[model samples]
Target chain A: MSTDSVTVHGYSTSGNCHKVRLVLEQVGRPYQWIEVDSPNGATRTAAYLAKNPNGKVPMLERADGAVLTESNAIICWLAEGTPMMPTDAWQRAQALSWLFFEQYSHEPYVAVARFVRGWTPIDSPRRADLPRLIERGEQALAVMERHLGRHKWFTGPGYGVADVALFAYTHCAADGGFDLGKFPAVEGWLARVGRTPHFVPMPLPHDDVRTLLAQH
Target chain B: MSTDSVTVHGYSTSGNCHKVRLVLEQVGRPYQWIEVDSPNGATRTAAYLAKNPNGKVPMLERADGAVLTESNAIICWLAEGTPMMPTDAWQRAQALSWLFFEQYSHEPYVAVARFVRGWTPIDSPRRADLPRLIERGEQALAVMERHLGRHKWFTGPGYGVADVALFAYTHCAADGGFDLGKFPAVEGWLARVGRTPHFVPMPLPHDDVRTLLAQH
Candidate 1:
């Protein structure tokens, strides 16, 4: 990485964090990655909290000490003035709508389910929420399926930050117990996203965690 | 409203919808409000779904037929080049981080608890989720409190969309059984938001719903 390259603090296994890495790669931006193991309490340290009071992973820090969190916001900043972001104001707003929808509608259900299954102990009370999470996650996937039926990308006319944002959790939905077979259009879109130039898949969960998720 | 003004479709009592109205009023923009009774199913109609497949209200329609949904996204577009938005790219990213945090970390807990208290029947099974929701909502509030202890506004320098986005549910957190009195800084921040020029309070819930929420 160049001396002035942006620095990203993230956890490799987190879809939220991975989205930033995906964008940086796709846009050919040089950046340094510092792994912050959020699930294991690394983000709670005073040093980490000093940088991000919110204590979430996927924080981007500039050389001048300016910091930006929220995976989609960082991606938007990185993709600005590139084809990865739309030029028209209205289309940009539409792209943002999808980004918001992904966080509010999709990630809460899907990503949380994956975390509950893989990261938490088998007897944890959060596992009880699985059924509801799966049901709600299906609804979110159906919305994406309906959108993809008519449009190839969430951002008007091409793949962009919205697509990257949604794809991060969605391509891994099966790990959350969501069946992609139910939404052919979404499946096709996921393939399209994977085929993007410089695209990198989210790192796989550890073997023991994968075993736990499978058993669950 | 002027002939060229945008039209906003929203439910009066919804914090998400009210955020849009608050921004438009604060910015002195002329816009028509079409009350869509989202709680009573207006937003779920085929006609409404045609405009927004997500079937949520607070959708803005331009005179030329373009539409934008997502309250924060709408406000950003409306506040573009205005004091309500940060002109610096990094500050803009900071504002968006708060917006995403509102939707992801804050709204799901605070807003949903309020909805459950007011909109659901007294004995609804969903009421069982309130304790967990309150616990999580309080955590979200604490983050805001900490931020308020240092910064005057969520948007970098002044009252902006992030402030508007957070204020909507936060001001009414009491309706969800959250005692804002616990967080002096958050309470003060709420007052600061209210004092912004042309600020408008969210509409009160209907009498029966208010009584229901009060009992809870």
Candidate 2:
């Protein structure tokens, strides 16, 4: 690991965790990855909560003991001064737009859907919201499809944090029971992001995500 | 208007409105500002809604006629390729972390509180939510105070989109009936953002936001 490196606390299969790791790999930064279990209440521990009051990962711990949480924020900080950010103001905003889209329009649906389908059992109470969640998730994907049709990337011409933000779960959306074939543009965009140099594949969670779901 | 520049839709007083304007001024870009009224349903018209299906302002219309909405996203697009984005991967993440913080933690409290207090009439039914809103708003401010206690800027020394994201409502937080004096660090940070060369103030909406809220 590089001396000035940082450590990321996250579960292997988490989309948010994947977002940070992708940046680390792309930037060629030397950082250690420490797996933290979310299902087992790993984030609720006092030590983890101290790092992030919100009790979410992936959290970045700098050498100075300062810890940062929120996957997109960590990527923005890491990609600053790099080519990851657009050169133009409008382009930059576009990048942020997609990120916001991911959080508000996308994550609430896609991320939560994954939790329901992959983290919870079929008969679990959380599964009650699955249908609506999946429908909303498809709407989010529809938004992505419209945008990806024009731009080669989320912000245009290059793979930036926006791509990273959307790429996290989009590739694995099928596992959430999303029929990825319906969103051809999003599928094409996923292929493009996967082709980026130094791109890292999201690791399969220790418990096969499907297996975890079956238990739920 | 600067030749070949961009155009922004929405009134200045809007928190999202300020985000786009802040970056334009910060980056020295020449862009035309077009005022659109959301409260008055100006954004609901065929022409405006055609540009953004979401019917929100703070829309950035590019020279090529592509329109992008969502204030934080717009600002990030602007800040890209500038020093506003951190150089290191970790630093970039920090910036996004704060941006997310602004959206999830700060905006819901500060911005929503403002809507409840400043935009709504004192005796309006919305007032019932104001006390709880203010209570939660203070909690958000406390989080910011704790973070700002150590760092000069939300992401670090150099200001980034995260600052813009948080700054939009923070400066106008008082109008929302928030006690600005409660958080000195946020106050200082606001002053610093205000001092940035060429920084522009958000113009209050033409139709009183209060009247708009009463209608709701």
Against the native chain B, each candidate's TM-score is 0.97, 0.89
lDDT, candidate 2, B181-209, per-residue tens: 98999899999989977788887654566
DockQ of candidate 2 against the true complex: 0.45
Question: Per-candidate interface C-alpha RMSD?
Answer: 0.9, 2.6
**Fnat of each candidate:** 0.76, 0.73
Q: How would you encode candidate 1's per-residue C-alpha lDDT over B1-216 as one tens digit per residue?
A: 223589999999999999999988887888999999899899899999988878898899999887898898988888876799998877888899999999988998999999999999999899998999999899899999998888999998788989999998999999888989999999998988888889888888999889889894
Worst 10-residue lDDT window for candidate 1 chain B reads: B1-10
Candidate 1: Cα lDDT at A82: 83
- The DockQ-based CAPRI class assigned to model 1 is medium
Candidate 1: tens digits of C-alpha lDDT, residues A23-59:
8888888899998878889999999988888789999
Error of 1 at A3 (Å): 9.3
TM-score of each: 0.95, 0.76
Model 1 misses residue A26 by how many Å?
1.5
Residue A174, model 1: lDDT of: 84
